[model samples]
Target: MPRRGGPPEVNAGSMADIAFLLLIFFLVTTTIETDAGLDRMLPPIEPPDQDVVIKQKNIFTVNINKNGQLLVEEELLDLRDLRARAVEFLDNGGDGTCNYCRGGKDASSSDNPTKAIISLKNDRETKYATYITVQNELVGAYNELRNREAQRLYGRNFTEMEAEFLNPETPASIRDDLKDKVKAVQDLFPQKLSEAETSASN
Candidate 1:
């Protein structure tokens, strides 16, 4: 009998090409997720020329320990109450210069919006999440006041005004008008937050 033909040789030449094609497909179709963090622009470093004095009442102190405990104005405080306390401190209008202010006008709080400052200090081992939350609450306080002022002045929300100002399709004249309004709102409640060096634990 004629010798049986050897088993047909299998072709392995295209395997590498197939793998390459799959790799390319996955590379092209895959999506990458990114973590979101605070949107803050750091100020340029400047040498201090001389000591600057700030009134005690104008400064709102917030301290955070490694255990995520909050000490606001020398008192232990819960996270949920931070925003309201910040708002009260910033909008106190103690100096009577802010004509549109509807605050309690407490003499022990901030003298005016212009001079108000929120000073935040955290322990070196503090949790990042806790720090971020505290920052959010403080910023939210500013937003709340700005929104109130925007509504009273322009019959529109501050965020709405900012959105219109930033919209690319808005007409030049209208955008300019929105720009002024947004600036006015920002001037009324300028953000003046100071982040200090983390304190070392004992």
Candidate 2:
């Protein structure tokens, strides 16, 4: 159909350009989310081919019942007192085995730090909080000993030396030295927390 003098037909090519620009804008504005989880370092794999006998007297047993109760050495203990007791047990050098051990030679308790084993047992229904708290106290006892040894050897706290060793900004030479210091501290107070399964009665 012909009209008198029509203006002109609008070109449809520019519309495609507008739609492409909108697609680019949306792509630029989009964001992607990621899942997060707790960072826990797992223990090294150990072969069960070897068997070693652990003396009964040398073992300090900690039991957590389903009622969220702590029984250390068969005696119910308060959470506040567990750390000090653990310290005493670890520091005792009864058998003349640990020269650096400062533990009281209580005939009824562990013979030496080397022989002292902190055996933790928990029922299947035990509270996680109770088990975690006991574990924390035991670890704290070991750290306390390690820190003391580090101070004696390096004239600094264990944490300070460890920080320097792990710091990304630290010089390679200094970090290497700190690494040895950290190892020395850990060797002095070797963590011996052994976990065992237990019956509900315990």
Q: What does candidate 1's lDDT look like per residue over 46-134, in tens digits?
A: 97799888999999999999999999999999999999999999899998998877789998889899899999999999988888889
lDDT of 2 by residue, 55-122 (tens): 78888888888887889888999989999999998888777777887777777777877677999888
Worst 10 residues of 1 by lDDT: 34-43
Reference-based lDDT, each prediction: 0.92, 0.82
TM-score of each: 0.85, 0.71
User: Best candidate per TM-score, number?
Assistant: 1
Off by over 4 Å in 2: 1-51, 198-202
| Candidate 1 residue spans exceeding 4 A from truth | 1-10, 41-51
Residue 36 miss distance in model 2 (angstroms): 12
